[model samples]
Structures are given as C-alpha cells and as structure tokens.
Target: MVEPAEFRSYYGRPILKEPAWKQPDVPLYLFLGGAAGASASIAALADVTGRPELARAGRLVASGGSIASVAALIHDLGKPTRFLHMLRVLKPTSPLSVGSWILSPFSGLAAVAAASELSGILPGAGRLAGAAAGLLGPAMCTYTAVLLSDTATPSWHEAYGTLPILFAGSALTSGAGAALLLVPSVETGPVVRAGLIGAAAELAAARHAETGLGLASEPYRTGRAGKLLKAARALTAAGAGLSLVARRNRAAGAAAGVAYLAAGLCTRFGVYAAGVESARDPKYVVVPQRERLRR
Candidate 1:
C-alpha cells in the first residue's frame, strides 16, 4: 500500500541552473540561421539554373539573416565587443566558435553575392560566393542543434540524435518560404518540392523524438512549449498542403510562405523554452538519473 504524501520544509530554490542564453535573442538567432542557411542553398540552385531574380532574392535574404543572427548574439552577450572573444579559439567542443567561423564567411559571401546581383558586376565572383555559401549553409543550420544538445539540459541532450535532422528540415522550409515570398515568380516547382519534403521530414523527426524520448520529452508537450509546438505542427501541415498549389496561385504561395516562417520561429522558441524549463527544474534532472540507475 502507498503512504500519503506530506509537505516538507526546506529553503525553496532551483536545484539546477538555467543556461546563459537571453530571451528573444538566442531563439531569434536560431530561426534566422535556419532561414539564412536555406536561402544560401536556394541561391546556389538559382545561380545554376539561370534564374537571376530568384538568385538575387536568395542572396539578400541569406545575407540579411546571417547579419541579423550575429546582431542578436552580440546583444544577448550584453556587449558588442564580447563577440570577438568567440573568435579567439577554434575548439572542437565549442559550437559557438565553430558557428562563428561558419557565419563569418557565409555572411561575407552572401552579402557579396547579393551586392553583385544588384550591381551586375563581378559575375564570376558572385557565382563563387554563392557556391561557397551553399557549402556552408547546411552546416550553419545543423550546428545549432548540436550546440543545444551538448549541454546538461535533459530535453536537449536526449533528442540529440534527431535535432539536427529536424532542424535541417526546418531550414529548408524557411529557405523555400523566403523564395516563395520574395522571388517574384510563380514558377516555384523547386520551392514547393523543397518545402513539402522538409515539412514531412520535420514532422517525422519531431514526432519520433516526442514518442521515443520518454521523460525528457514532457516539456515539449506541456505548458508554453506545448502550445507553440502544437501551433507549429498545424502551420507546417497547412503550409505543406498549400505548397502543392503555390505555382498556380501566388496568393496561396505567399500564405504558405508566411506560415512556414512563423512555424520555424515557433519551433525554435518551443525547443529553447523546453530546455530552459528542464534546466530550472531539479526533478527533470534527478528523476531521470534515478530512473536510469533503476534500469
């Protein structure tokens, strides 16, 4: 028979510490990085296919997102100069350092490509820049997933195996969304395909993570995180369904693009919030460890 619980007295405080990330900035950075990475991929594709307008839009969005992501990081650090410290080392264990290195070149190349498109100068250089960004773009999106998981946060660490895949899918969705929104063309076959495939991948990965992650996945299905995740999933589903008709109806394409961007941002915020909650609650840590020991 189970005994009745009694209230215990102790100094009330969090048993675990929250991560050193700031609100709006870190999550914003994650969304922007994904958008930028996907833009770069689209830019490279457009360049190869002789679609100058599409290429221009992709380059500008990639450059803008890359620059904005850095600004958010600097703001989160509470000092513009503190960003320099992240560049001082290249440690394999430090995702910050690796991401800094990636973002710097990716930003510069993306900007140059966009500028060249506007000026109609240095076509060869622009192509080279676009090519480079294409290589770095996927890495930029996937690395942040690794960054969050390589921490003491249970919600993040347990889903490590699927986070990168999920983010990659999300990045493609945003990338395709940006193209649909800004490219000024109704021939969005590539965009639709990319978005549809990415949406499917994201849904599959997220569902699997939720189902298989056990206790660590609770935060993702409860409270603020749960609300955001639910909305994201709904938006992704609707956007994917609409993507099929994007080429026929520009308005539908635009709607799908907006939905995809919103969904991506929601996902970033949801995952970050869940990790923070897991970190702040000692039961998230202690109970998991205890259960592991029992097993």
Candidate 2:
C-alpha cells in the first residue's frame, strides 16, 4: 500500500493568505460590539420591567460599548474615512457592508437611549430608541462572526455554523456582566439568570465546534489560542458557579461579573488568534483541500 502523501507548500511558505486585520483591535471590537448589542436588549427589558437602576446601567454599558467598538473598528482600518467609505453602499452579500449599516444605526440609537436616560429628557423617544436598539441587538452580536466566517480562514470558515451562536452567547454573558457590576444584587435577578444561560450556551457551542471542525480545530487546541480558550472555559465555568451565590453576596456578584467579562474577551482573542494561526499553516489549507478533492 502506498503511504499517505505529505502536505507541503513551495519553499515551506503558507499557501493561504493571512488575515490583515489588526490584532487586539479587531478582537476588542468584537467583544465591545457584542456587549453593546446584548446590553441594548437588557436595557429595553429592564426599562419595561421598571427596574430603573438596571435599566440605567444597561443603557450606559450599551452606549459606551458601541462607541468603543466604533473607535476600535476605525482604528483597525487605519482611519475614520475608510470606515465611513464602507457606508456608501448597501450590499446584501457583503458581511462588512451589512455590519456597517447595523453598527451605525445601533450606535446612534444606543447613544440616544443612554443620553435620554441619563438626562431625563424625551423619555418617550428614549424608550422607543432603546426598543429599536434591542430589536437590532442580535444581528449586531452575530454580524462580526459572519464577517469572520465569510473570509477564507480555515478554522473560522469551518466553524461558521456554530460561531454565531457562540458569539451571541458570549455577548449576552458580557452584557449581563456589565449589568451585574453596575446594578445592585437586589435588582440583578434577570442579569444573573441570563449570564448563566449565556455561559452554558457559549460553552456548548464552543465544544460542538471543536469536535465537529475536524482538522480545522487544531488551532483551537494548541499554542496561544489553546491557552486563551482554556482560560475562557475555566473562567466562564467558575463565573457561572459563582453566579448562584451572587444573588446574596455583592462581592461574589462582582467577581462573577468580572470573570464573565474576562472570559468573553478571552474567547474573542482566542478565536482571532486561532484564525491567524490557521492561515499561517500550509497544512491547514493543503490537507483540507486534498481531502475535499479525494471525496
């Protein structure tokens, strides 16, 4: 029997083009966008339920996160004009274009809602804006994942089916963390419950992706990416466990919130690192293509 063929590229160079997106900035934008989207939803629900403090916290976090996300994206693009130029057209097939539209409107609405909530002006309009932002929250949370998956990155493309769900879960958890840190324990019942659910969903989706991605999952299980993802899993699990006790202890609640937020950050960075690593390895590209051709 003939031996299996060894995958190699000319001069040992990577066959796939690595992503040019700046590090830390892109991942930070992902985290902030997710947090902003989910926080908008939390703010709307809290306002409807008459939880004024929670609503205020959620509104502030949502607005702040959105602004930060914009700054990060613009920074990644190297200038403000580049980001603005993306808004010139609406392309249904382009994740970047669609994401820009979603992000722009959501940022404005979130800022408006937060401003009104803070200044106690135009409460009616603020409520409407907050509700509108909430309506767009889910799309905002998952659009980044779609953008990443739309690329040629092997690990990211292979996990596209589960990436959006993982991102949504992470977003919800991050939003809940912000609320828990700002609002008192007495008014954080919903936030705690949401965080628990988000943590569980994120963990589940990540596991499913790792197991189902086959060879593409290697990046997620090795090197810097592996370390970050492991930390994320541990922190998320610990935070979820702490959430049970957070209902009674403010300190525990704060710790849990921090843990959740940190975990979400780690997850985004881990995913980014994994994609970059995958692109730098010719084996990840060649082996997969060869397998497809063999079938």
The number of the candidate with the highest lDDT is 2
lDDT of 1 by residue, 3-52 (tens): 95332224756666788899999999999998999999888988889787
State the weakest 10-residue window (summed lDDT) of model 1.
Answer: 4-13
Q: List the residue pairs that clash in candidate 2.
A: none
TM-score of each: 0.95, 0.97
Taking all chains together, the TM-score of candidate 2 against the true structure is: 0.97
Writing each residue's lDDT as its tens digit, candidate 2 over 1-295 gives 9998777789887788899999889999999999999999998899999898998888889899999999999999998999999999999999999999999999999999999998999999998999999999999889999999999999999999989999999999999888878898999999989998899899998887667788999898789998998899998998888888887999999999999999999999999999999999888888888789999
- Number of backbone collisions per candidate, in order? 0, 0
Off by over 4 Å in 2: 1-6
Evaluated against the true structure, the overall lDDT of model 1 is 0.86
Per the 3 Å backbone cut-off, how many clashing residue pairs does candidate 2 have? 0
